[model samples]
Target: MQIQSGFLVFLVFYTLITLVLLHAVYRTSQLIVDEEFHLRQGEHFCRGRFHVWDPKITTFPGLYLISASLLGPFKACSVYALRLTSAIASIVNAYFIFIIRRTVVGKQEDARVLLESISLAILPPLYFFSHLYYTDVLSVTMVLMMIYFSLKEKHNYGALLAFFAIMMRQTNIVWVGYILGWRALDLAMKLCLPNENHQYRLRDLLTTVQTLLGSRFMFVRVIKLIFSSYYGYILNILAFMAFLYWNGSIVVGDKSAHVAAIHLPQIFYFTLFFATFSGSELLTLLPRVLRLVRNRWYITAFGMALFAWIVQQNTIVHPYLLADNRHYTFYVWNRFFGRWWFARYLPVPIYYGIVVSLAFLLFAQHNGRPPLIVSSLVWIVATVASVALQQLIEVRYFILPFLVLRLVQPNVRPSRKLVAFEVAFNLTVNVVTFYIFFTKEFYWSDYREPQRLIW
Candidate 1:
């Protein structure tokens, strides 16, 4: 009966998310310029053609390759086809979440599942991402896969999954490389020596490096290279693309390269990176944030999110603040925070962030798990580190790490009474947010548009 109830709740939450995302994809189909590109790619990719050079004459072959690969049965890239792809990715993502919650947290967490339910169900930023169409949907799903499979001790499969994710979108190149390479080396060492913790010997490391740079081994070699030297992988991508453009088959437009290249003062960069990227040096903030969660954390988090939103307006013009492609999390938070001005005045993003943080911090403080010690620290530092990029919010970066605390940390299940209380309080927040967002403009319209306008 208990299992049945949990499964039922999960399905209900899943159903709600599906419905909301469908609405979002349909609504979003009309808004974003990127969606049009994705839609066109879905349409064009079905024909088995690859574009290397011209968007007018050729498209970005990468994402389209993904779409085409999925086109085994679909006829063309209509709204249904593109959205279907998005839907499939969402289901896969949700399934990954279910898997994590079930295995990582559920099995052991008699009390922890309460926290999981609250975090998964009511976290506004993550919830918002579910309804939208962006590379993040896929990137995050792959990230969960990487984490889950790696933890499950399926190193090769996990590495392969991480590889696929990086291929789909380049954002994870650094994180995935670090994670997969470390694990692979660890495993190789274990395999090489039956005892005494030996693997990936000195010679193995040299050979692996040679194999990647030399490309003698090909697929495996490239994988090793991607992990060994990620920047080089990105450069190889740019060089190959440049090669096509040089040969005249493709025309790469825009001053994005120029834009990304124009340097800001290192002082400003340092400040931005420091504030955004949390390191061991910054663990001081965690306790502060945790303390805030005891009472005023939601209000403080909301205010900070608003500030991030406000600053992000300038982030666009000065890519130094945020890369053009990044910063959606802040943007979304700004939007959700702005919803306070909607028909009834609500703070969807802020309210959720606050409550979620409260639950997470309080649970960690109360439970006191040993294994979670390092994971929690890593997540905190990384989440803070995420802000340094400044261009796009890409909420998944922080949210993913934030989520680890709930999953890996110990769970002393709150009482049925407390769980019921949290569930109710959180549901109220969600209800209010849905009402506000349904009636209002995009999430960050209030803070963002004004900033964008004033600047």
Candidate 2:
């Protein structure tokens, strides 16, 4: 009865949030930079000229096609129609989060699942994107569904959803790689060494590698593993190549803007974002991390070195930040400490240290379980890889990485205090951000103007 009542309350909460977003459909008349291009792309799609490839286009046609199809009838209300599409996607995303958590933990975690579902729904990042007409919400929803089906061992369905996800956002190729790589690892372990249990640690990988090296006809086994496990990934890659062939290039937007250029600073930024978004999980792990590094003089020495770097570091602005850096996170950080070299830079190194220390601590704590350790490491790798490949910084890029924390950290029911803090923080940010979106009017006379108003 308690579980039923909790789910019932969640439904009411979900419905109320959804209704509020829907109410803003017409009122939020502003369009960010990407939206203008997507709206144009949708117009092109509506006119039957499907192959509207350009040097500045980096994304697939899935989003534009989706918007055009939905807006076909409501031509006059296209903007509202597009926003409505995102609003509906938000609700569906919340449902998937609920179902996935329930599937993972089973019926025993009814209340916890409800809490997590609500958390996912109201997470400041997801909530902010839920109000816009961009592809972030749709791509994230498909990615979550793909992950859910993959966990359920529904490979075919997962692959299909993955294909759609990549279609929505090219960066999602990492997810496809993650899923297929995991399967490959599992298969190689099973075939190469029958006696060993599957685990995700270096020891397991080393064991598999050493066994293959020592075995007769080792090359044949390696080939067999590749052939057996990589068929799905290969198919997706081929599809992506075909998409590029038809579109004239691998990316749809400005190649310079979207290309995979390595930026090391992203490692620091993303780690902090995850640590912050993970909220109390990292907080609760503080003791474990301290204990893990407590006696290591080298760690303490490195900590001091990191501290020095933080104090000396300065804000590194790229073309993106210079245009408009009005995001709440940036705004708040800058307002409080951005002016001071150490104050602004301090958080970056601190976040990096916390994430690295916590990860090593978890590994030491769970040394015997390779599968648990390895699966999480895979997401972290994907998170880093995704950000490293980006040309610019944006909070929305962190959405998938933030979601991947579910796989990284063990599922712990948030304490009442943590829950309250998250609820209050996300609610405040979303309400304020949405208010800006609803009232702010867009004028294309200056590109930087919109950036100052949003974020």
Candidate 3:
């Protein structure tokens, strides 16, 4: 009864918010370049440019096709129409969030799961993007659906949704691959180990490989199992390659400018965001953390200062404040480290060391490693590593993985104080960010002229 009531309330609340966002975003005069470009591509597709490719475009045709299908019927190219799609996608995403919560926390804790769904629905990062017409919401919605089906033990449906997600955003291949990889790992472990109680070790691996190879039939069976489990991933990879080939380049947009490169600080940035988002949950563990850091407060302080200094030196400048080099990104990269290669790249090793150490500690704290828990950790680490390999550093890139990780997290049964804090913090941040989106201007600085926008 409580679950039903909470769901009803959330439905009404989310619907009202979506309607307001759709109305406001459609009427706004200001346009972000990313959305504008996507809109144009949609228009072009509607006008029979299906076979044509644009080198300037940085993504697949999934979103363009979606928008064209919606707008072409009415002969509308309005920003509102694009955002209407996003609004609808977001609602569907909320439903998936609810289902995911129920799956992770079980039906017995209906109220808790409902609250978790609300937290997901109100997540500021996703909320901000849902107001725009970009593929972010649509893609994330598809990804979430994939996760839902996977958790329900429906791999066929998950694979289908994953294919669609890849179409929505090519980068989704990494996410889909992560899921499939975990499944493959789980299957391999099951096949190689004689019993569920077997502990995996170097010697055990050697013995298993030798035993399997000694029997040709068993080796053949192992090969068959491997292929059968991962056929979907193989198909997706082939599709991705075909799309890239048809697009006439392995990557879209400015490849030289945005080629794959290791940026170790990405893990740090995303981990910090996740920690902040659930700061209340983490506060419970603060005593232990503090105890670990006791007598090392000065070292911790120095490390934070060093991190701040490094950020100051390598911040990517935002276009709106380019003229004034006082902005955080500008101050860090331009004023401090732009001219010195040594200073610019000096933090890479330190970040790697810290992130790796923390990740191992996190895994160690889990005690018994169930397949589900181990797979989840692997997925999180792989997702973070994927972003770390990217040339660009965008907060949006981290949003889906963060949400997914949170969704799969164990039920904490947070105290009333913690729940209240989370609710208040989410509400405050959402309201402030929403107001800023409508009232303020930020700029995309990659172009020669730079474009004015709000995000």
Candidate 2 lDDT: 0.67
Highest-scoring model, TM-score = 2
lDDT of 1 by residue, 66-169 (tens): 66777745565556555555556666665566566677555545344534454454444455544544455666667678778767866566666666665555
Please give the lDDT score for candidate 3: 0.68
Name model 3 segments beyond 4 Å from true: 46-54, 74-76, 197-219, 241-250, 295-373, 441-455
* Local accuracy of candidate 2 as per-residue lDDT tens digits, 144-242: 888888778777788888888898998898887777766666676677766765544667777877877788686577667666545656588678778
Per-prediction TM-score = 0.56, 0.84, 0.79
| Cα lDDT listed for each candidate | 0.47, 0.67, 0.68
Instruction: Point out the higher-scoring one by TM-score: 1 or 2.
Output: 2
**Candidate 3 local lDDT, residue 37:** 73
Error of 2 at 437 (Å): 4.6
In the range 286-313, model 3's lDDT, one tens digit per residue, is 5555554565677666666666665654
